[model samples]
Target chain A: MAKDDDTAFDQAGFDEALRRRARMVEAVLRQVLEQRPLAGEIARPQRLIAAMQHGVLAGGKRLRPFLVMESAALFSADGEAAARVAAALECVHCYSLIHDDLPAMDDDDLRRGQPTVHKAYDEATAILAGDALLTLAFDIVADEATQLAAERRAALVLALARAAGAGGMAGGQMLDLQAADAPPDEAGIIRLQAMKTGALIRFACEAGAIVAGAPAAERERLAEFGSAIGLAFQLADDLLDLTADAGTMGKATGKDAAAGKATLAALHGEDWARRQLAGLVAQARALLEPYGAHAAMLADAASFVAARNK
Target chain B: MAKDDDTAFDQAGFDEALRRRARMVEAVLRQVLEQRPLAGEIARPQRLIAAMQHGVLAGGKRLRPFLVMESAALFSADGEAAARVAAALECVHCYSLIHDDLPAMDDDDLRRGQPTVHKAYDEATAILAGDALLTLAFDIVADEATQLAAERRAALVLALARAAGAGGMAGGQMLDLQAADAPPDEAGIIRLQAMKTGALIRFACEAGAIVAGAPAAERERLAEFGSAIGLAFQLADDLLDLTADAGTMGKATGKDAAAGKATLAALHGEDWARRQLAGLVAQARALLEPYGAHAAMLADAASFVAARNK
Candidate 1:
């Protein structure tokens, strides 16, 4: 384990760490979205680049990236490489948000308390911006600056692609869109949530292991930990959507309910959902127990994910 | 050169070869887009998959894939590997087409004589399908089935990403969208066409070299050939758009002039565009001259691209 892994976990400490990592990710993303074009590129359209920056630079907890960083730290992975991977993951996350907020999808005007990409720019720009951001994620991972071995870099690309592709996040989005016409049953909702949100979060943790060249056993363990936290994250999100106001959430809340989308948290009632979150956080922490002190930050992350208000 | 390189490059032979390679690419693409989800995926949403198939499986010449296959053949690369790379390039190409046909973009209802994805399905499905296809392209390249060294796979991913991302195809699309409001000058039109269409074509030829583990000089040569052909391809396309009817082109034509979007061919008139095309084909063939008989098919391809009626 890295020396940094010995840091004690506390609510304030975890929050501070999350913010710091968000800043790190933001800095990397800002550079990635710079005005100058890369080699083999003709020119970067100002409107497209501006739209991409608007979608990605908006503030959030950067929870997914935090998971990548902390998970990598547990495996003693290179911090710089982990940061790039985190930023790449965040790009995928942000791109999905941009697309999901398009008029044909969720159709929201506000995101992170600002006009969504489609609202700020035209719909065509927003679509292209999202496409470009998604492509840029792979570019970042496969670039030499990530400083990983060729094999590790290839593995990262494969894993990230799977998590973000048809059978994963995008597929999940498709299911979510269908949910309005035919609300899913409990099992279907779980599957939808797992694919929609869990896959990327799982990849975030697994990416650390891939970057560190950790053993398969360790990779699987981190992945399982990720799965637990992923469920908890979604359940918590659904819970917030049910109870929180748009002002508190920064985006519109109660959207799932309005769309008649069935969520486990909504279906089983808030009480049951809270209990599930508790169990999931516990399950997530337990998976990390084998790592002892090195897992402290990850353990804190699970709790934070479940308990975050917005 | 392999034994296959000895074949004569008559028009019939070249057309047959192109069609053969297109079939190979289509087969690979079909398998890649199958209903069965890959590992780590929860489920493949049916509607999204169908929409993706509708977008991709619609028949075109598969010119980009053909370029990749032929370029790889120049270096004696594995045929199967080349085919996979070809399919991946086609995915990016198809994704761009799907998104570009959206109401917010080109607003076209027809593509290749069939209803566009958004017309056949809804706009949301079309968007998701495009997004998924783009993501799947990287997934296909990075997969072990490509049977390349990890370093080569990573390079392919990097190159493909750069070609398809903000500074390349997507960036070009943005510029093309903006062209209606502010038509580009001659130089600007060249840059826009290069990014929007040339980047992927360039990547296609360079990919064969990358897959074959060809040396830098060889790669550069193929890339330059690609550039020459790419410009020729766009010029030919612009000419056709100005002269051909929708019944012949199988999609809208003369839209560049209608939309007030400048193209070199449209700006300079038919005679100049034809002269430029002839020069570009000569330049392309000259780039491949060192390979002698081995590059005969590619030489033919340059002429074919510049002279194709549709």
Candidate 2:
């Protein structure tokens, strides 16, 4: 482990890098969303665009986009391509948040310390906004402006679709819903976590490799690294749900426990969960050891995921 | 105009071809959905898959897939590639239906003569299934099996995404919702209908040319054919809502008027709408004239869209 001085320096660097990448992602997203599907005769509805912007521009931490950018950077992919892909991933993340906060889903009224999309807009607009954002992600990634080879772009699109689709995030959400009736065991909980959150994180890392046309071995390692950190992220999230307040977290935290969500942290006690997170972070760091100081940022990211308070 | 005998022959051929393509789309969809996103451990939640199947396989007309197939055939694209693309389009269509039928949206209880996905399953399941289906469409089209150049596949993904995104289907739905409060003029209604239904239809025709790498002029003409037929289809739909019963249509009819949707058929009398439909079909058929007999199926398609009883 790094000394306190080194850890603090790394943390500051990570924060600065995260904020910079997030800003870039935000700018790219704004530019992409500026495009209209029909330009000449038909115009984009102001209200729908407003709703979409509301869902996306809520100013969250933008962790997923950060993951995408940092991972892509590790493979020396084009910065523009990485930013475009990161923007696309952020769109998916924002869209999922909007839908998940709907009355039918998590039913939360708050996100990112503000009113949720469904709360800010009507339920219908919220749903449409989420749908539109989801659709836009693929569109942004596939655009020629991404400047990736056609095959790489296609691969990225396919991976993203898989990550977000059934058997992944959506399917895991279903499992989470079912857990209300009958909570799964630890293994099932882990599988659910892997699908629900881990899949996208894994894709974010692998996308870097695909965009860079990196070796398959490197892709696998990066994916594994992402998966480990993803698990660690979820464990930390569950911990925060137990320990943090709504004011800091930007949303209701205790709801997961109240809803009887079968999280790994719940399955194994808090201390055990913390240990697991630490272990996973260490494993993730080890995965990047071959890249040396070039991977210091990713190593710090893993630590951040394990240590984040909100 | 064709003679009565020729019309009958064309109609029969069109019917046979449509059914054949629909079946093919169904088969491809089933095969695609059979593969789990996480094969061994996470396992696709059977319930979510079931809900998706319920939404998709409930036996609608599959008109969109038919259009895709006929259009692709015009370019002599590979049958399998066309089938895969058609299947992807069907997935998006089915997903839109599932979402449109949500309680917060159109609130329809029945679809395709059966309970909607939300009615058959639950609202959350319906939303997730719809989400999964939408994600799955991109996955299917971007798959290696589509057998197109990567750029073509990327283009297809981008087109489909645009057709389904904020400026297209979802945005149009928002406009339709707004029309309930303040009805749009005739042009507004036409624009709404074009975005809501015409976008995907146009993409279906254009996708064929794209996959085949056809000339830009050919793509534009096919797109025009699709747009004309799309307008005709919507006019026919509005007329059916006024004329048909729930049983015949396999779902609620007359709901659009009740919802105060400002459709062209509602703006103009049914007779005028019928005349417009006829004009649009003629225009659609004329656009296909350059393709000669190779476009007979497309011409038949235009006629069928205007003439579909349900």
Q: What TM value does the first chain of each candidate achieve?
A: 0.96, 0.94
Worst 10 residues of 2 chain A by lDDT: A1-10
Q: Write the per-residue lDDT of candidate 2 for residues B1-310, one digit (tens) a residue.
A: 2223222336677788888989999999998787465331246888999999998888977888888888889889888898999999999999999999999988989876789999999998999999999999999988888899998999889888888888778778888888888989988888889888888888888888887878889988888888888888898899999888777887778888888777778778888877787788888888988889998888888888887887
Model 1 error, position A287 (Å):
0.5
The residue-level lDDT of candidate 1 at A290 comes to 92
Model 2, position B171, has a per-residue lDDT of 78
In model 2, the clashing pairs are none
lDDT of 1: 0.90
lDDT of 1 at B257: 83
lDDT of 1 by residue, B180-228 (tens): 8888888888889999999999999899999999999999999999999
DockQ of 1: 0.84
